[model samples]
Target: MTPIGTQELDRELKKGSAELLILSLIEHRARHGYEISKLIEERSGGVLKFNVASFYPLLYRLEERGMIAGRWVEKAGQRRRRYYKLTAAGKEMLKTQRSTWRDFVHAIQVITEAENA
Candidate 1:
């Protein structure tokens, strides 16, 4: 049984980490929306999932903010899919976000460990 506070914390953590997760996934290459969703689920060991309704808007928002760029691509036999890639700004954002997340986790660890000790 999960406590209410724990559930709330889970939601907040997911909201805060969504951008970093998405940005890191596409740091190396462009990926379509579904592929990104699958990777997140797989990599998280089924602990995290993003549906299209919420996921697409996040992608569009990132694109609009110039953190990412999207273009339609079609393979020889496949339908066109809009793939997203990190922009120069996104690389910088990723770097900053990575540092921020690391600091945040470290702080949480210190506090929790101090409380336990």
Candidate 2:
């Protein structure tokens, strides 16, 4: 699809920033990759979508860095799914990242729409 409206551009921006968003989501709860993708989309009002290939490597890297923990869970006669949860270190990091993200967005909002200039 061709790039279009402001909402579309907003989606593009969120897609580019999805790794941080996913980490933020899982910092609260352990989520499988697909579930993370869904929550990003849902929470963002359908503005964020993550491709599996891009999303998992970042998840693995965060795990490797001890920023997050991953586990595989299996149920009786069910599929095993990888779930990601925040480590204490990850929660600290996420607190900082979230503050940064909020500040960045607020700065943009202020510049773009502040008092209608």
Candidate 3:
């Protein structure tokens, strides 16, 4: 089998888990785009990062799909920001996605264990 490069692996991981990461973060509380990106980066110890160009479009798509809701808010002495929160549908989606991810991880673990045995 062919080997995968680091760049290719990073791209594949982002494509597969970007939505799950976003959804899981917003599940706890509403956060603006920058906050979401920062949290993902920080939480992953700087291994994962999302650029604005890619992030905003994905957020908008989630809003359109009714998975999440975004609202603009103004704070005293601060610029307005749009915050996103998970909706009921988003909660349901998160549950399903979490299960799917667990299953995928388990399968990978099993295969790797067998290979290493």
Most lDDT-accurate candidate = 3
Q: Model 2: per-residue lDDT, tens digit, 1-117?
A: 675999778757765576578778886578888888888878878656666787788788889999889999988997899999989888888788788888999999999998898
lDDT of 2: 0.81
Count steric clashes of candidate 2.
0
Q: Which tens-of-lDDT digit does each residue in 1-117 have in candidate 1?
A: 956797678777778999999999999999999999999999999988876888999999999999999999989989899999999999999999999999999998999899687
Model 2: ten consecutive residues of lowest lDDT: 11-20
Q: Compared with the true structure, what per-residue lDDT tens digits does model 3 show for residues 25-104?
A: 99989999999999999999999998889989999999999999999999999899999999999999999999999999
TM-score of each: 0.91, 0.80, 0.93
lDDT of 1 at 74: 88
Q: What is the lDDT of residue 92 in candidate 1?
A: 100
In model 1, what is the error at residue 70, expressed in angstroms? 0.5
Pick by lDDT: 2 or 3, better one: 3
Deviation of model 1 at 25, angstroms: 0.6
lDDT score of residue 93 within candidate 1:
100
